[model samples]
Target: MTSARRGGRPRSFRSARRVRHRLAADLALLLVAVAFAVPLGWLALASFNEHAGLRTSLPHPFTLGNFQAVLTPDTTYTPMFNSLLLCGSATALTVAAATLAAYPLSRYRSRFNRPFLLTILFATCLPITAIMVPVYGLFVQVNLIDTLWGTALFLATAQLPFAIWLMRNFMDGVPTVLEEAAWTDGASSMQALWRVVLPLMGPGVGVVTVFTFIAMWGNFFVPFMLLLSPDQLPASVSIYTFFGSYGTVVYGQLAAFSVLYSAPVVVLYVAIARRLGGGFALGGAVKG
Candidate 1:
């Protein structure tokens, strides 16, 4: 018994060392998470406190006036609605166009595909800022400035390179044989793509839609340049209105509006997470 107890000491010490290392790693991660979360937490707390500034504090006596002030017709309502309309349209257009574009890329085996894909990769890496001056000139020539639909269309087009790249990868994981069976049933290529391929790609579709919506929603520059009307602004630009011309600012209201502005993206993320309950087994997607 004495000999066995002594032998167990080394194993116990090793286990203790592992636990200590794991605890340290966990503490480091916790600190990192808190660092990221602190500003967001502060915003939420300040949103509820009428007297709150940019600095975080526990709300001494919480009030909903900041939110109420922002939500009134003169400030947040029009911009928030415009953002929803513009972002939703852009997301729908981008997803539909990307689906069509990805189908051919995923289905065909062509020599041109690699070069075309490389072109798209290069386009994806191109900074939007670099092309904005040219885009603005093009918009002026076409008389598309101040038009919501035009702006949404441009947003969709701007995001196409990335969206098509992501969608094609998702489409490639789906088995070719499924579409072949649909083709055998006398379905046209587009019909097969629509009826067969898209049904199985619900999660992928959700991901693309969420991504496009968030991108458009958060984009300040595109709309800022193209949209001339104050009524057509999105929350991203409208948030700047809280900063007064004389350098005075409405910190509490800004925080409240920020919370509201970020809600849609958060909701979309949660919905997508729930919709994608588990990763699809691409093993079953293709058989060796």
Candidate 2:
């Protein structure tokens, strides 16, 4: 009876301890989540407030004037449009270029392959800021500066190494037997790639698309340096223009514009989140 009572007490103690640990962990996670969410919540609330109201410490009445100000013709829609255009074109180019480059890397194994792959990986590791001056000078000499095409070309090239690496990793997971069978059935190399390999690469393709879009969309420094004209600037540069070197910052407008700017990205992630997980997993699997 004493042994049974002893066992019961110990078991109860452990159970209580476990419950306390779980409760502590849950509380920690909840606190962390709240910490992360507060800024976003504040930003959202600030976006709807008036410029005068934004300076206050407490919650104030909301207005759409900030968003209205952002939407006005004199503000920055043209730059936003330019950014969208450049980013879209750059993403398409990256996808095409990466796909082509990846196939060769995945399918062929020559003595030069390792060195070439290493070179790409090395390029990916280097900061673009390191080469910014030289790239800008080359663009100026070629008279490509301030052009959307030029910006797109630069963005595409910068993203190429990472994109190729990602695509090659994805392609490595694909069975070569499928391509061989296609070849046996009189399918050309292009046909096999298009009909067989590509369909299986949907996840990797989606991952690449997301990466390219986000990178190009958010890039500020390159666009700021290359694009002198306001009309040619991207959304990121336009956001900077909202701030002045003097006093009295337009916090309301800035917040409103930021919220609006983030909408597309939020929508994109919401739309692709389901696919992103699988795609990322497959891409990583290929690498493994």
Candidate 3:
């Protein structure tokens, strides 16, 4: 009877302790969630409120004027177009170059491979700000400053080292036998990569593309510094226009523009969410 009592007491204590721990964790998570949700809630509510301030509250009298005010050609349309053009081109360039650069590193074992990869990894850690001054000078000398294509090229180069590392890791997951088989059937190295390896690693490509696009899309400093003409400014830089010179801000319009600016990235993620979740699709590919 005494031993049973002792065991029961310990078990009860453990159960109570577990319950307390779980409750604490749940409360912490809720607090974290609320922290993020508050800003988003404010953004949504304030966009429709004419008298929006730095608070989250429902619009007493909702209006579409905020969206209407920001939908003009110069304010929204041209900047959106420029963002799409610049980011889209840069993403394509980054993905293509990363893939080609990663292929040999992933496939062949070379004495220099580890050193090269380490160098690339080190490059990713270097902040863009550190190199921007030299980059700006180089751009000026080449007369590429203020050019969208030039900015896109710089964006691609900036993103490449990380992209190459990511691509190599993904490429490693693909079986070399697939490439070997393609080569046996008269396919060249590039042909095998294009036809066999790339098709298999669709998720990797999608991830890289989305990552590069989103990064460049949200980037303000590089574009602002490189492009002199307001006509060439992306939505990221154009967002500053909502800030008045005398410390006033068009809060409702700013919130509305923020929603629109974020839409494309959300849409892109939704479009590829299924494929990314599907993963490598490599099951049974190497089966005997």
Best candidate according to lDDT: 3
How close is every model to the real structure, measured as TM-score?
Answer: 0.89, 0.86, 0.88
CA deviation > 4 Å runs, candidate 3:
1-12, 244-247, 269-288
Cα lDDT of candidate 3 equals: 0.87
* Per-residue alpha-carbon lDDT of candidate 3 for residues 1-288, written as tens digits (9 for 90 to 100): 999877777777889999999999999999999998998998999899987888777985799989999999999999999999999999999999999999999999999999999998777777787678888999999999999999999999988888888788889989999899999999989999999999999988887788778778888778988988989999999898888574888888899999999998888878867765766542221111
How far in Å is the alpha carbon of 193 misplaced in model 1?
0.9
Q: How much is the lDDT of residue 72 in candidate 1?
A: 84
What lDDT is reached at residue 184 by model 2?
99
Q: Looking at model 3, how many pairs of residues clash?
A: 0
Stretches > 4 Å off in candidate 2: 1-10, 52-59, 245-247, 275-288
Error of 3 at 5 (Å): 12
RMSD of each: 5.8, 4.4, 6.1
